[model samples]
Target: MTKWSYDTNGTPGLDSVHAHALVCVTFSVYILAQVLRRQVRVTGLVVTKFFMIHVMNLAMLKLEAGVWGLVFMTCTLLYFYETLPVRYLPVQEKVVLITGCDRGIGHNLAKQLDQLGFYVYAGCLQKGSEGEQELVRNCSSRLTTLQLDVCQLEQVENAVNKVTNELGNKELWGIVNNAGICFVGNVETMTTADIQKLITVNYLGPVNICKAFFPLLRKGKGRLVNISSNAGLAPVPEMGVYCASKAALATMTEVWRYELQKWGIKVATIIPSGYKTGILAYDKQATAERWWRSASDAVKEDYGKECFYAKPKTEALLSPDLSPILDALVDALLSKSPKAYYYRGIFSRALPFLYLHLPTTLGDLVMKVIGDWFISKPLALQKSSKKF
Candidate 1:
């Protein structure tokens, strides 16, 4: 064999330069195409084009970093590709239980899985609610609807018993912990009761459901799919309680993943970005009014009546498509090897990456700027003369 000599010169070889250039150009093109396709309005298009130019400029800056940069880039691409294989297991023999099937992602996922031939047990909070009724109307014989309140331990046990009785010799393959609630308010404005409610529904609900169903999952060598939020990964101002609750659930899921691996029970946490679901459609104004009315005179004076009542201007930040989340959930459930963490929706992956990589000060500053731009004072507030 011929001996090889390593390059000792500081200057990059021609091959290295060409490789770096190719990577920069290819990535810039892909990003530009994504921006153009997703952004539809004239203003959005102009803004996106400007953003893409900035990204291209950053990409060009990597060209001067030489061989090491190119090598690192190549390795990253290879690792990403290797990790994202699409291997799925047959679900016809599997039995799945999904909570909060009365509406939103849970409703859609239950339907999709039912259609895919999984014996789906949908957990609805209300048996005869409009959403449950719709699910009943649309579903096939493979789908079964059960009344489930994840927050109540007795109800969770009853659901477990019902599913156990129904499953007979078949094992319970998966449990989708999709039941949750969202509460938006400043920490000062949010009452003890409000915080408790948020914690009960968003965090403890999953805990109760998972604990009851984990044994069955172990028996089946199945998976647990928890529907978390992007807020769990990166906390947002004014929605502190909601973020905290989701964060708790995420941490719990991670711990369970470590604990359950011995039994071949996979755990997946799905962190979705904003979607136009029932949670987002909540009447913020009415909630604000209720908080204002309950506030003590001393508490009211410090924050101001206007501040307490202010409704942040709401807009859909990401695509309303529930398909991505549903697909991710299915992959977590049925894939022979599922990802431990699935970040779904636009900006879901990017935002978390930035938050984890950026300096603490820089990340805080970025968040502050975003909060200032998006959060605004309420358009209307009832005048109050009361002072502590």
Candidate 2:
């Protein structure tokens, strides 16, 4: 080991290193201010001056005791890279396909992307339906409404053919697998058919679309954006089957990302929740009632009716605006270097960190507490002497 050396000026070796680290940190913060100032000019300046000051102070002390100034510099440079302003590709001449455009994020995205000058193929379950008509009426002639029930393979293939014919010489820029269905209920209360329905629409639907469109994506060198959920990251009460299906999609998205890298095709997943979407049944009470009715006698007896009624009556917490999700999707498609996962909406990132980073027991306790805030104990369980 090398002996510790003292500076002639009276500063200790460790103290000298700490001073160097602090100086590096201060310099990084100044650089950050310049970077962020530019970002503000371009992107409305969400980063506050106060935040920059706080970040500088935090970063300075964070590595004061460390001897490795090189490590500190490397981390600072990484931060600079991540914090830099995002650049988006020109929307003109881009042809993008979006599923589940009948409502919610898909619908909004189709319109927004259309407005941004992209030739949008808005896929709806029902052609000539009110939603489809609304899109056609509002969007330019560039936007086309296509019938796409993602669960149907024939429909997916037909859509591919139609798109291929339309593109002829040009290339497709992006595909957003926004089609999905959500069913909320206790795991035991959900019938096999119910679970299958969720899987078919949420998981298998994306698989079929991606599989069929892989060639087109490869040809276009385009990106694939899958609409996932925060529920997929953590176990949410009453959304067990829905969460599982999204989790499957999330996993497949990762695999697709790795597999498509060689082809220059980017794959991204948008993790969003608590947005006012058609998939979210507004009348939770009615949904609970439906689940209760569908439950077998054994399930009914085991859980009891009172327990199921505890589901939230209204999605009062869901945001009416879908701009955050739309912006995320746009980034996933148009950014030069798209992130593998874009977490949007309330608790989108936090829920995953809680589950993945916390101790199992602590995480479970926290989850249970959150669950209990919205739902009461099952009638049968309350009557039993045993505790969960």
* Total clashing pairs for each candidate: 0, 1
TM-score of 1: 0.78
Where is model 2 more than 4 Å wrong at Cα?
Answer: 1-41, 46-80, 282-289, 373-376, 385-388
Candidate 1: count of backbone clashes, pairs at least 3 residues apart or interchain: 0
Per-residue lDDT of 1-388 in model 1, one digit per residue for the tens? 2222345776435454456557656755654564466422234544554465445445744555455565666665454333433447777679999999999999999899988988999999999999999989999988899889887788889989998898987889999999888766777776778889899989999889888888888999998899888888886777788889999999999999999999988899998886765776567678778888888777676666666553545444546788878888988997777888888776677667778999999989877765554334432322233331
Model 1 lDDT, residue 281, Cα? 59
Off by over 4 Å in 1: 1-73, 310-314, 373-388
For model 2, residues 216-293, the per-residue Cα lDDT tens digits are 889889899998898888888777888899999999999999999999999999998778887865466775678788
Which run of 10 residues does model 2 get worst, by summed lDDT? 38-47
lDDT of each model, Cα atoms only? Answer: 0.77, 0.80
lDDT of the structure predicted as candidate 1: 0.77
